[model samples]
Target: MRRTLGRMLADSRTQPAHAPGASNDPLILREARADDMPAVLDIYNAEVRTSTSTYQYAERTLDEQLALLSSKQTAGDPFVLAELADGSVGGYATYGPFRPREGWRFTVEHSVYLREDCRGKGIARPLMRHIMGHAKARGFHSMVGVVDASNAASIRMHQAMGFQVAGVMREGGYKFDRWLDCAFLQALL
Candidate 1:
């Protein structure tokens, strides 16, 4: 029972001038639309197939993306997509339970991805802040970001957002024919 992008935007009482003109800003952060599946999937699959941002070795099907959207919508998770000035989906961010156990309910893990061309335009900070506020309002006590050890940009961004490196799991993941370390960072809400 996910809502359409049109309805979501129209019903959003706090929609923050996403268009280009008076704001002079072209980037739009909003709830992901079903029509944006292809672009979002392309972005995710590219990372899954190439980068260490995601450890999954296989690309996901469109149906998987649809299912994810449905689940997030049902759970009231904050899944947002970034739209470029030209209306293309440039990136996305979402968070889910850090662990499934009842005692872990107060913690969550977040992931943010931006298209190569769209990086460094000051998009991630606001997006992360928005999600942080949403999680805080929902009574989450902390947020965790598990980053690839070699992803300096992501680590820096998390640090800038007040997340501290909790620990590192040495050689925690195996991908692309090599072992990858994961850096765990946490921020108390």
Candidate 2:
């Protein structure tokens, strides 16, 4: 089943380009490579320090990010990125196992991040669409996103993609010296 699904995705055509005026920036989404780690770390660290998108406390080193990327690649998991024409990493999105339990093997959780300046430009929508399509074709039964309750934009975006709120865990995370709520949204692939 996995081999057949992989073959189908490999033969599938690329998604259509963003419509005119969708985004002023010329962005292309593709699988992230080792060379993209530095740029990916920059965007990820920025979000860590300023946004509740991730509950991580400290910035990750380039080596650490590369190791994570390498693990994903080795596991055949997707680590995708959106790049600007100038080769800067505009954003990245990826998924991994939702739980360690064997029963959850077909469920995955994903996250997406865009550089601060890249927000409000519709970059995330197409990025997510691409990821979801890939996940479905790859036989993932469900896709989940754990979003901070304070992040309205991300919550709305997930909803627009047909994800529904599965649950909300109040004060589930402590970050930046405060308790944070996490909302889980899930979509059946």
Candidate 3:
């Protein structure tokens, strides 16, 4: 079945956080609210500290995160959260205009961050699929992901979702006392 924002939003509204004694926990994708900022920020900041996934050197402040959340919400951009069946925030995905130029209106660049413990749990693929469906519904023509060159798992996942590597910028980013290459992966809506 196709995933749509409307369907996910409805599911978010109706699904209970968890069923008592349930052995398997389902993944839930929903629009992020202001209250979700703390959890989202924690996931992002952890990546900032330990990974090359983001080129940022300093950890993001909560106020800054709050402002970003507010802006995305106001602009109707997709800023979504992925929660466990127990209602704990495990990850988040968001996208914004690829560039400020008018011609770039139909393109977006996205980011996904998952908590350390959430890796390999099959969360990212669904979150990305949701973002693509949501963006396509909003009239976007393409979505891009700028992933670290060394992140083969992420590249493979995007490839599975129909994204292709468009280009690579060698040593385009610096973090952790070394240069990092960034690969641009694009998918048509």
TM-score of each: 0.85, 0.85, 0.85
Q: Per-residue lDDT tens digits of candidate 3, residues 1-20?
A: 11332232233334322111
* lDDT of candidate model 2 versus the reference: 0.79
Pairs of residues at least 3 apart in sequence or in different chains that clash in candidate 2: none
TM-score of model 3 relative to the true fold?
A: 0.85
- Backbone clash pairs for candidate 1 read none
* Runs off by more than 4 Å, candidate 3: 1-25
* Models ranked on TM-score: 3, 1, 2
Whole-model lDDT values for every prediction: 0.78, 0.79, 0.79
Off by over 4 Å in 1: 1-26
Tens-place lDDT digits, model 1, residues 1-189: 023322322333233312111223556879997888889899889899879999999899999999998888899998898787788887889999999999999999998988777788777776787788788899999999898877767766676676766776878999989988887878787
